[model samples]
Target: MASKLTGTVALVTGASSGIGVDAARQLAEQGAAVALVARRKERLETLAAEITEAGGTALAVEADITDRDQAEAAVRQTVERFGRLDILVNNAGLMLLGPVVGADPREWERMIAVNVQGLLHTTHAALPHLLKAAEEGPRQVADIVNISSIAGRQAWENYGVYNLTKFGVNGFTESLRQELAGRHVRVGVLEPGAVDTELGSHNNATIHAEMLDPFNAQHERLVPADIADGITYMVTRPRRTAIAELWVMPTDQA
Candidate 1:
């Protein structure tokens, strides 16, 4: 059988580890030329080597998505190397949750920059290529998957800024989907809940300790591959199908 994504090109931001890394690998396994973008050169290089060694096309792009120039460069490099861009996964994000009243203002700014602005920068740069790729490509369709959080859908006391950024991502993804629907460019959002990743590492010690209570109580914490599975399903669909919004949470999660 022909590979689902044969002859396609995909760019995944924050692909050094976690969900982004897994998604890139899964896409490559389906036959897309994968560009892995992240700030950690060593990690990106290692992952790229693994993918290439496994008979998949892979490129390591060291970039900070928060930097507009770097973000744009990553997308340009993908097109320059692969000749077209079929998938853009805006997976780079920051989540630092704490009480709104005493939370460091800097943390809020950082979340906004990485979670919101970074997505905008990458999407803005990749839009033209994605639209063009949809015109004529292996699948005749292109996809942009923005990684959001369950917090985007609901508000909690201490997660004010993180929720704000994710909510912005949801709105942005929906608006872009509407704008690009006629063009055959599918835009979607993947919202995951309490995944076992480094997302919580940025939280302050106090907040971390506070989070441990509920986090530990939940026996079934989600793995990175769980989120990757949802993403893979989204992009691997036939050109005629579009999964606009996907919410994935551990079955035990409530």
Candidate 2:
């Protein structure tokens, strides 16, 4: 059952919208007390209310996880609210795409800050708690799920920076998985292709119009809940089972 998180607590970053919020809801539905982490407080609060109305426990934590202090605080708040964190979803990231030749360095920096640094900060802050949870939790297991993208696997001209960040995520998750396996803290990555999120809407106007929007209009996209479902499956396995990686693509996305 997806709605059975009776005693677990989960922290989902970027939980204001899209894959983040939906994944948080899925975890909450599955019986976990969820902590919603994102910079946007109002949205997080709204999502938290909806989860509560659905008879689930949730905490809305406003945090820009790109900032290390905020990331630490987010994890601390989760531990304070529910005593332990059994699941950590590092889903707080953005992509700003353009050709490397004339791209703004700021864009690259922003992608690195959130996609790479943000994930790192959250994972680092939550690791100790996750380790402890694995030792003293009802499920006898813990999970760290990093959200990546198809760009992580394939590089394209305009996707250089985004690709770099996701590849970093891939490498980091694998290394962490190996380090934490013996401790029962399962670490993994989810690579979803062309999800129907507002991920590209934030790109520079030129990139959005010429690069992102056209492609988005051409293809069917996976919804946020689709990725959320993947996350739920990864984190809910029995203590003896660990799903190392998952790559789900839209039927039309090659």
Candidate 3:
């Protein structure tokens, strides 16, 4: 039997746009109170308003998950406002693609900070509350869904650093799932391929001109909602079933 998410509270990072935004809306539709976190306050406020007007509960939490203190505070604020945290979607990430040689080192640093450290910061802060909710909240199981990418499974030449961060996410999620299985905290990694997101726009001019344009041209891209549907399915599974990982790609891509 599928588990219903009624009366549950879910915290979603990067809720300002793309897959995160779609996932937040979907969770609300499934009867969960959503805490939307993002660096863009206005965007978060707008999304929250839309959800609330549709008869769902939403909170706009403005925080850059890259900062450890801000990440912890986001989790604390969600628990304070909603009384518990039943689900955490670590969807905030920075994707900068370029070749390792002669690439702007700063871009690599930013990617690591946001993609890897940011996930760790939020997950660490939310883990305790998630475990508590699993033990005593309305739902007997809690979930932590980390958004990885298909790049995690296979590396591309110019996308080296981005692939590194995603691969790290995959390993970290698997390890966390093993550690938390006994506690009923389900940890999952969602790997998506060639999604039509703002991800490529973050690349430097050199890489964008030389690599991104060509790569995007050849791929049959997916929409953000497609990835959100995968997340919804994973979280809605019965307590006895945990979807450890999912890989989603455009049907015509391969």
Candidate 4:
């Protein structure tokens, strides 16, 4: 039997680690040619080799999605190599947790750059190719899966700017879903609660000991593959079905 994505192509950002790495692997396992994008060239190359050894086509495109030129170039490279793009997973993001008062504005800027502006740049570049793929490719559909967080739905005290970025992601996803519904481009947001990824390690030591450490000790966290499963499910749905917004949380998370 053939796989669900035998003729499709997918581009995954932040593919150097965690959810992005697993998402790329799962998509390739389902037979989609995958382009892995990240700043860590060595990690991306290793992953590409691993996928290729497993008999799945993969390409490593070193890029920082925060830069508009690099983001667009990554999309162009994917299409150039794979012929067309049927799915785009915007998985690159930053999480710097702290109170709004006396917080580092630079950290907030970084979060906004990677979380909000990065998503926009890649989406803008990939939209045309995805639109074309939806109209003419074998699947006759295209998908944009933005990896958000549970923070998008609820505001936590130390998660102000991170919350803002994710909330923005949810809002943008909804608007795009509506606009592209008629065009066969399905835009969806996947919000995962407290995953055991490097996302939490970026915080300052104070934040970690005071907030993150306790949270981890209390609640069972999710794995990268868990969120990757959600991503795969969203993109593989039949053309008539659209998973607009999916919230995947650990059972222990409230």
Q: What are the models' TM-scores?
A: 0.98, 0.97, 0.96, 0.99
Best by lDDT: 4
The collision pairs in model 1 are none
lDDT of every model, 2 decimals:
0.91, 0.92, 0.91, 0.96
Clashing residue pairs in candidate 4, if any?
A: none
Off by over 4 Å in 4: none
In terms of lDDT, the poorest run of 10 residues in model 3 is 1-10
lDDT tens digits by residue: candidate 2, 1-254: 45556799999999998999899989988999999999999999999999999999999999998899999999999999889899999998898888899788998999999999999999999999999999987888999999999988989988998999999999999999999999999999999999988798787788888888798899999999999999999998889999989999999886
**In candidate 3, what are the lDDT values of residues 90-165, reduced to their tens digit?**
9988888766888889888899999999999999999889999899967799999999998899998878889999
User: Candidate 4, residues 102-160: lDDT per residue as tens digits?
Assistant: 98899999999999999999999999999999999798999999999999999989899
For model 3, which pairs clash?
none
Please give the lDDT score at residue 91 for candidate 4: 97
Give candidate 3 misplaced runs (Cα > 4 Å): 1-3
Error of 4 at 3 (Å): 0.5
> Compared with the true structure, what per-residue lDDT tens digits does model 1 show for residues 1-254?
86899999999998988999899989999999999999999999999999999999999999988999999999999999989999999999888877888667988889999999999999999999999889987788999999998998998988898899999999999999999999999999999988888888777787777885568575677899889889899999988899999999888775
Model 4, residue 97: distance off in Å is 0.6
What is the descending lDDT order?
A: 4, 2, 3, 1
